[model samples]
Target: MSTFPGTAEFYRQFRPGLPGALPTLLDQIAPAASPRRLLDIGTGPGLVVEALLERFDDIVALDSDASMVAVAESALRTPLPHGSRLQLHHGRAEEFTPSAGWQPHLVTFCRVFHWLDQSAVLARLGEYVAPEGVVAVFSDRSLWTAGNPWQRAVRDVVQDFLGTQRRAGNRTFESPGPPHTQVLRDSPFSEVTETVIPVRRTWSADDVIGYLYSTSFAAPYLFGGRRANFEAAVKTVLAHFTTNGVLLENNAFTVLTAHRPSRHGKR
Candidate 1:
C-alpha cells in the first residue's frame, strides 16, 4: 500500500511551524468574499484547513492516505472557543464526491495535485464547488529560492535524483523547491490565477533526510537499491553545509488559484 508520508514527512520536517504562514496563503487565495463551506483535497495534515477555520464558518477536508488523514482529522478536531467549523474525511480524490446536501464555496489541493488525474479530479471537483466557488492549487516555493547555501547544494543533489527519475514531494526543511512539476493545464478550472509568497522555515540535517524520504518517488529510491549512495549524498550535503547547527533554505512557489464561477451551481 502506498503511503501519504511521501508527502507528509517532507513538510513535517518544518512542521510545528510551516503552517504559521497560513494567513498569508489564505489572503493570496482571496477569501475576501467569505466562504460558506470549504473542501481541502489532499489536505496532508489540515495545515490549510486550520487556516480556513479562522476565516470561514464551515470547512470539509479529505486526504487519501490513512496516516495523513489521521493527522489532519486530529488537527481539525482540536477544540476552539466557537467550536470547529471543519469536517474531515479519508478517501481518494476520485472517490470523493460533493455530498448532495452541501455545495462548498471553495476547493483546494495543496502540493499534491500532480499525483491525481487532473481531468477526472476537476470534473468531480466542479460538482462540489458552488457555481461561483474557486479551486486553489498551492505550493510553497521559498525553500528552493531563499536562504541557505548548503540547502541549495543539498537541493541540487536531491533534484539530480528527481530529474533523473520521477520524484514528488521533496519536503526538506529550509529546502527550496525543485522546478515546478508540470501539472495538467486545461482541466476543470474555468479561470486560473497564481502568486508567489516569500517564506522561510528552520531545519536540521536529519529533517532534510526525512523530507527526502517523504517524496512520492524519492522514498522508494533511497530505501531501495541506491540506499548507500543516497545516504552518502546526504552525508556530503550535511558535512558541507552545517555551520554552528542550522541550515536555512530559500524557496518560493506560486500559490495558484483557479476559479469556477458561482453561476454554475447552487448559489
Candidate 2:
C-alpha cells in the first residue's frame, strides 16, 4: 500500500473524475428496487463515491493512506448530499474486514487494483459481497505511457529530474503479476466484461505540472530541495507543446466488471 502524505492534496486537485455515464452503468447492476450499497476500495479523495453518490445510498470509502482518507472526508462532508451515508476508513484493501451482516451490492477499485494483492482481496470480498453483486476495476491510460508528443515531453522532463525508474511510493514501481483479467477469472468472480471509454482532456502547463505532482512517480517530495527547479524545467518543456496556452489529448478510461455466474448459470 502507498501513502500519499505530500501528494494527497495535489491528487485531489488534479485527478480526473469518472466519465459522466459511468455511474449509470454501475447502477444498472443491482435490482432497481433494492437499496444499493457500495464499498469503494482505494477511494482517493472519495472520487468514486462523489460520482455515484445518488445511485448508492450507503457508501464506505476505504484507502490505505490516512492523508488520502482525510482528504476524502473533507471533500465528501458528512450527511452527504442527497441523503447518502458516506463512511471513510483508513486501512489496506487486502486487510479490510467488512462490518457484521454487511453485504455490499457493488464493490469498486478505482485506479488502485494494481497495488492490491488481487487474489487475496477477491477471496475476502467473496465473503461479504452480495451473491448477485459485481466488482468493478476502473483505471485510465496514464500520461506515463505517453501516446502523443506533448505527453512524451512531460514524461521526459519528469524522468530527467526523478531518474528513469518508475516510482511507487518509496519503491521502484513494477506491474502486478498475472494481469487483472486473468486474476479475476481465477477467483470466485469468473464472469468478466470490459468497457473502454474514450475521453478528451485539455491542460494548461500549470495543469500538467500539478498533475505530475499528483502521481506517485513525480510527487514534489521526491525532488528534495530541487522541487522548484523541477517545476520550472517542466513548464519550460511544456511550452513547446501548448497551443493557445493548452495541451490536448484523447485518452481511454477502462472499466473491468466481474461477477460470479448466477445460480441459473447466466452471466
Candidate 3:
C-alpha cells in the first residue's frame, strides 16, 4: 500500500512552496561551475525541482512514494530550458544510484529527511556528491504543533477523533533521533550551518481542511467512516479563530546546510 494514498491532489493544492529567495541563496552558496546539477530527495510534488529548474542543467527528483512520484511527474512535464533535463524516480533514497559521471553539485532533502535512514543516506550521498558539492536540509513546523490558537484548536479536534498519538501511513509516527545537525556532523559533510526564513501564511477554513487531508497524520482514509464529521469539527474550530473566513500563521522555514571543509579546512 502507498504510504500516502489519496492525498496527492490535496498535497498539490495545499502544501506551501519553498521561499522565493531559496534559489538565489543557493546560487550564491553552491559552486558556480557550468552544468550545475541538483538532486532533490523526497521531492514531494516536485516543489524543490520546480523552484530550481532554472538553476540546474540536470535535476533528479526522487521519492519513495509512488503516489507522490506520479503527482510530481505529471506536474513537472512542462517544456524545459534547452539542454536541461529532469528525471523523476519512484524509489527509496538508499536504493537509488546515480548514473555514471552524474555526481550532483547539490543534494537537498526538504521536510522529509526524518523519513530517511539518516546516517546511511548521508554516507551514500557522500559517494555521489561532487567534491565541492553541498547538502541542504529544509523543514518547517506544521500547524499541529504551532502556538496559534487556531492551530491548537485544530490539533485538539484531530486528537479527539483519532487519539493522542500521531498516525503515519499504517503505523504510529516516531520521530527520528539525535537531531539532524548531529547526524550531519557524523558524516563526510561535517561542516554545518543554519538559516531561518520567517513565513506568513493565510488560510481559509476549506484550505485548512485540505491541508490536513494532505498530511499522513490526518488523511481522509484515516478518518474512515467519520471523515465528514471530523472535517465538520475542524471547520467549526476554524470559524471561531478566523476573521472573515481567514486565518493567519507565522511560521519558520529552517535550512540546515553541510559541506566538506573549504581550502585550509575553513568553512
Candidate 4:
C-alpha cells in the first residue's frame, strides 16, 4: 500500500515547514560553490524544494506518490529565483536516475527516509553525488508522538479511536530496522554527523485535527466511514488542552548528514 494514500491535500495544508536554522545548518554541513544542484527525495508538497531554491540553481524533486507530486507542482507555481529550476518526478528513490550531465551537490530526505531501505538508497546515491557531496536525512517528532501531558492526551484519543499501535493502509506499521545514524555508518556514506534544533509552535484544536489527518498513521482515510467521528473526538479532546484556543507544541527537529571522507580523511 502507498505510504500516504489520499492524504496529499491534508499534508500540503498542515505539514510543518523546516526550522529557521535549517539554511545555516545546511551551509555548514554541505557547503558548495555557486550553481549548486540538489536532489530532494520524497519531496512532499515541495516544502524542502521551496526552502532550498534560493541556494540551489537546479533541483530534482522525486516522490513515489503522484498526488504528492501534483500538490508540490501547484505549490511551486510562484516564480523561482532568476535562474533556478525545479524538475518533479514521480518515482521511488531506489529507481531514480539523475539525467545525463546532472550531478547533485546535496541530496536530502526529510521526514520520509524511514519509509525507504536506508542501505539501498544510500548505495544508489553514490552514483549521483558530486565530489564532496552530502546526503542529509531530517525528521521532527509530532506533538502526539511526544509523551507530554497534552500530547499524551491527544495520543490517547487517537488510540481510543484507532488502536494502541499505528496502522498504514491495511498494514500494521513496523519500526524501521536501525537508527539512521547506525545505518549511515554501515553504508558507503560512512562519514556521519547530526544536528538538532528546537522548535515551538502554537496550534489550535482545528490545527491539531488538520495535522492528524496529514500523518500516515492517523490520516482521515484510515478511519474510512468513521473519519468524521474520529475528527470530532480529537477536536473535543484538544479543546480541553487549548488555552485561548491554542496548544503549545515544543518539538525538536534533527538532521543527520552522511558523506564520503575528504582527501584529508575528514567529513
Candidate 5:
C-alpha cells in the first residue's frame, strides 16, 4: 500500500497532466451514456470519482484505506452542476458485496488495479456492473519513457527508489497496456481496447519531489522511509533547471478497457 498522506492531494497533484493518459480511457468509454451509477474500484482519494461524476450521475467510490476514504469523502461531498449523487465506500472490491438491486452503469479503477487480486476483483466486480456496463482500468505511461531530460531525471530517480521488485512486473510506458487486461481477454470481457493518450506534466523541482515520494515504489523498501534519500536522488537527476519546463517525451498513458461479457453465469 502507498503511505502517502491525503489521497485526494495526490490526484490534485497528478491530475493537471502527469502524462496524458486520460484520452485512452475516455475513448474506450466513448458512446458513454449519462452513466446513472458508477462503481469506482480502489478509488484512492477520489480523483477518478470526481472524473466520473463530471461525466456521470450517482457515483459509488471505494477504497480500502480509512484515511483515503475519509479524504475522498471530504473532497467529494458536494454536488456538481447536474445533481448530488456521489457516495464513498471504504472497502475492497473483492470483499464488497452490493445489496440486491444495486447494479451500476459504469465500473472503473484508475491506478490501483496493480494492488488488487486481479482474478478475484474481476469476478466480484462482475456483479456490481449493470448489464452492458463497462470496466475500464487506467495507468500513466510516463514512468517508462520520458520525453525530455527533466522527466527522464524524475523517472530515473523514482525507478531507483522502486527497486527491482516494483520493476519486475513493470510494463514499458508504451506497450500492450495492462497485463491483467490481457489475462482477462479470454473470458468476462467481449472486447479489449488498448489505446495511447499522449499528455505532459510541467513540474517545478518542488512538484517533482512531492510526486516522487508519493509513488508506492518509493514508499519504504529501498529508502527505509527516509525521505531525504528520495529527495537526494531527485536533486542528483534534476541537475539542469531550464525555463522551458520538462519537454517530457511520450509522457502519455495507455488505457485498457475490458467490456464485461454480457449476461454472465455468475450474474
Candidate 6:
C-alpha cells in the first residue's frame, strides 16, 4: 500500500510542501557541519531531501515506492552543492542500511512514521545515528478530514462516491494508533520535544481535486469508471465554498523530535 503506483503523478503535482520554517528548525536542532549526513525515510518526491542538501553534505533518501523515487530523482536532477552527495534508495525503512563509514546526523520521517513499526525503527536508529543526532517525525491532518464546512462537504462527496468508510488501496482505513509522544516515550530514543507550526493554505477547486487523487484514501483507481463523476461532484461541492475560485484552509503541522540518547548517558 505504500507504493502509489497509480497516484504517483498526482502526488508529485499536488502534495503539500513542507512548511517554510522547517529548515530553520532543523538547523537549530542539528546545526550545519561538514560531513553532516541525513537519512530521510519515506522521502516522497524528495521534498525534504532537496531542502536538507543545503545543510547536509551527504543524504540518503529512501522510499518504498519506485514511482516516488523516480519522481524524486527527476525533481533533484539539478547539480548538488559542492561537496554534497545524494543517494536515492527504493526500499522500506526497516530494510535500509547505510554504506560502511556512513552514519546519519539526522533521520527524518515526514508523515510516514505512523506506517512503520515505531519501536523497532527507533531501536535501529540507535545503531545508525551520530551522537546527539535526532529522529524527527512530522504530520498534519489531511484536507478531507480537516475541521471546515467545505472540507466536510468534500468528504461527504468522497464517501458518496466511494463509501461511508475511508479506503486505502482496497482495504478499510483503520485509525492510526496512539500519539507519537506516547510511542516515543516507550521507545529507546525517548527524550522527546515537539513544535507546532500553524499553516494556512488556499487551494483552487481543481487543486483540491488533484490533491484528493494524490492520497490513498481517494485515489482514482478506487473510483474505477466513476472517477469523472467523483471529480465533478467534488468540484460542485467545492464551488459552493469557494470565493474567487479558491478554498482556504487553516491547519497545523506538528514535528515530534526524539533525541538519540547519548552513548555515555543513562537511558
TM-score of each: 0.73, 0.95, 0.96, 0.95, 0.76, 0.94
Model 4 TM-score (2 dp): 0.95
Once model 2 is optimally superposed onto the true structure by TM-score, how far is the C-alpha of residue 36 displaced, in angstroms? 1.3
Per-residue lDDT tens digits for candidate 5, residues 96-200, read 977677776667777777667777777776666676777777777434344576676676666666643443222222233457657568546647777667664
Q: Model 1: how far is 90 from its true place, Å? A: 1.7
Number of the predicted model whose TM-score against the real structure is largest: 3
The TM-score of candidate 1 is 0.73
User: What is residue 103's positional error in candidate 3, in angstroms?
Assistant: 0.6
Which pairs, if any, clash in model 5?
20-199, 147-248, 147-249
- Show the colliding residue pairs in model 3: none
TM-score of 2: 0.95
Per-residue error (Å), model 6, residue 69: 0.5
- Write the residue-wise lDDT of candidate 3 on 1-267 in tens digits: 666778888988898888877767776667765778899999988888888888888889999888899999889887567788898999999888989989888899988998898999999998889888889998888877788888989999999998889878678889779989999999989999888888888999889899999888888899899988998899987888888888999988888889986622212
Clashing pairs in 6: none
Separately for all candidates shown, the number of backbone clashes (residues 3 or more apart, or on different chains) is: 24, 0, 0, 0, 3, 0
Q: Which residue window of length 10 is worst by lDDT in model 1?
A: 172-181
lDDT of 2 by residue, 77-162 (tens): 85386666778999988899878977887899988998888999999998888888889997987889859898888788888987
Q: Which candidate is the best by lDDT?
A: 3
Question: Candidate 4 overall Cα lDDT vs. reference?
Answer: 0.83
lDDT of 6 at 113: 83
Q: Candidate 6: where is the Cα deviation over 4 Å? A: 1-3, 263-267
Ten-residue stretch with the least lDDT total in model 3? 258-267
Alpha-carbon RMSD, candidate 5: 5.3
> Per lDDT, what order, best first?
3, 2, 4, 6, 1, 5
lDDT (CA) for every model shown? 0.63, 0.84, 0.86, 0.83, 0.61, 0.82
Which residue ranges in model 4 land beyond 4 Å of their true spot?
263-267
Of candidate 5, the 10-residue stretch with the lowest lDDT total is 167-176
| Per-residue lDDT value at 44 in model 5 | 72
